[model samples]
Target: MHQDTVEKIEHALEGWPLLDSLPRECYGFHYRALCVPIDDRYDIFSYENAVIHKSVTAYYHEETHEYKLRMQVGFVEFCRIEYITNSLEIFGEKLSKELMQLLEDMVTFNPKNISSLVIKKGICDWAFAKELPETLEGYQLFIKPQQPVKINNGSYIIIDYVDFTHASDVTIYYNMYRDEFFGEARIHSIPDVTYDFDSNELVELQEKLEKHLVPRMREARQAADAAAHEGEA
Candidate 1:
């Protein structure tokens, strides 16, 4: 890979992952996963593959008020086969307004440290699909959390979809296991998600549904169009 290209890529990252090793599948593609540090951080990326290959969704525990960046990578055949946590919010000292803005990529942060990048396996979670996407669509969702889990991913449910066909909500179930800092998954609106595409790019109907998407869906549902609920997957 060209040093200049890597430098330019790093220049955009707020902070990169602590990579443990080059991913086995990174054989012929120019792909990267960046763990940025905005107030609500995300795992932003650019890839030759344009499907919803991987994604993340985060939730803050109000009682603790700490942030959790849930990480999920996708396989063509499976929904959430693997996951990892990037950072825990350290409400350390309040960052300067300038710094906070910088974190959100409102302003650029020097990615000169990009080449020194890494992808460490932080907290890891493995959830197998007990129910098929087609069948898990009823308001009833049952996921068997890992027994030795270190993080409470989410039992305090937040729903972004309320009206799609039972089959339409299956992707959301898979995205449930994705970590938020790696990449964002939202319900697609203009066009519904496609199954033949990669998971990363597969869903474009709506995305990052937790924040604005869910609220938008609620507002749209009042008009009797539950279609707003489908988002980035």
Candidate 2:
């Protein structure tokens, strides 16, 4: 990417909002779990056994009484599971930034040591429109069609937006049934490209988000709102 291109991306990303941290007394946590099976020694292992015999990584802050931990043992060295907390008690502070740091370090540190990678986060039992708004505000963050699949309860859809070469496309999952929306980005392998890895990664993300996702979201929200108003009139 050229310097001008890099500058453009950086400027656009600023338009997107940074996610807020979950309140200290959040109903529950939204976390990201990564799976990297460095070795396949524990093939065909029983799930029950793995649960019983788990490995744990924990961190505690005595001063603030902040405790964070994750427990899981590699099944015959077949899988290395780790979690980066999205929302937790970190001395009344949000752990998003810290979590992101951990993710970048772990993945890049030993890309070859891992076999598979997964990133997932959610707010369980969410309440729809009342809590999670349909309006998506940003430059070009939403996808077109804005279709939601109707279900027994309400509706939900996952929008695949943002491209980062080798990694999975960034996603925005919306659930009307649950009245919740989750945004997630995951990478299995680093892309072989030109721009600066450190500076350009987030910039690229912002560019795609602004270029594609935001506009679609705004359009959907407007249509939905208009329909609601027309029904009332």
Candidate 3:
């Protein structure tokens, strides 16, 4: 936006509890993120996944291991923070040097959060909950094994959260893995789906679970942040 606005966001991010809000683990990842969804739509299809930051960009992948770094970004961005160890630089920031340096020192600034997991059965997919089929304006309707099955991005299928009336209720998202040092179980982030529920009890349960989910994610994010603190020290 503006230089002053950019500076404010960067400064606030310094104390922004990304992990405290959404904590999950992936690969060798260890951090949580607070971010802006490009759009405000409750269910966005791979919305222009960009973070609000000006930083360096580079290719990052593990050399010896084929482990995939899952960069889940929306409210929070999480992935193996270590993966960016040698993968970034920032010479393009238009902001003055002093302000840019704070962000440069704080984050690696990669907004391309990629994931491979699909929503599983027990957990709630925000996408499925917000799915409004056959009647949604400016969007295509489709049926498939999964909810919100968009084979092609539509005029409405364009998942941009910046323009919507509803923002996703799920925050502080994180993934659970089996081993302490490795990730095995992946929690997927699907856009919210609109559903006409006949069961209030079911909706209540889902809402309860969803409410509880963020804190659990936060725990992991906190752990990740603590570990980061140790390593950085």
All candidates' lDDT scores? 0.27, 0.30, 0.27
Tens digit per residue, CA lDDT, model 2, 23-55? 222212223222222131111111122222323
Model 1 — TM-score against the truth?
0.23
TM-score of 2: 0.20
Error of 3 at 107 (Å): 22
Per-residue C-alpha lDDT of model 1 across residues 57-108, encoded as one tens digit per residue: 3323233324333333231121111222223322111221122232222122
Error of 3 at 127 (Å): 10
Ranking by TM-score: 1, 3, 2
Distance from true location, Cα of 67 in model 1, Å: 7.8
True-structure lDDT of candidate 3: 0.27
Query: TM-scores, in order shown?
Result: 0.23, 0.20, 0.21
Per-residue lDDT tens digits of candidate 3, residues 1-233? 23453354345445533223332332223332323322211110111223331122112222321111222333223333332233112211211232223333324422222122323222234443454243232212222112221111110011212211221222211222210110111123223322211112324434543444335334434444565578689
Candidate 1 minimal-lDDT segment of 10 residues: 115-124
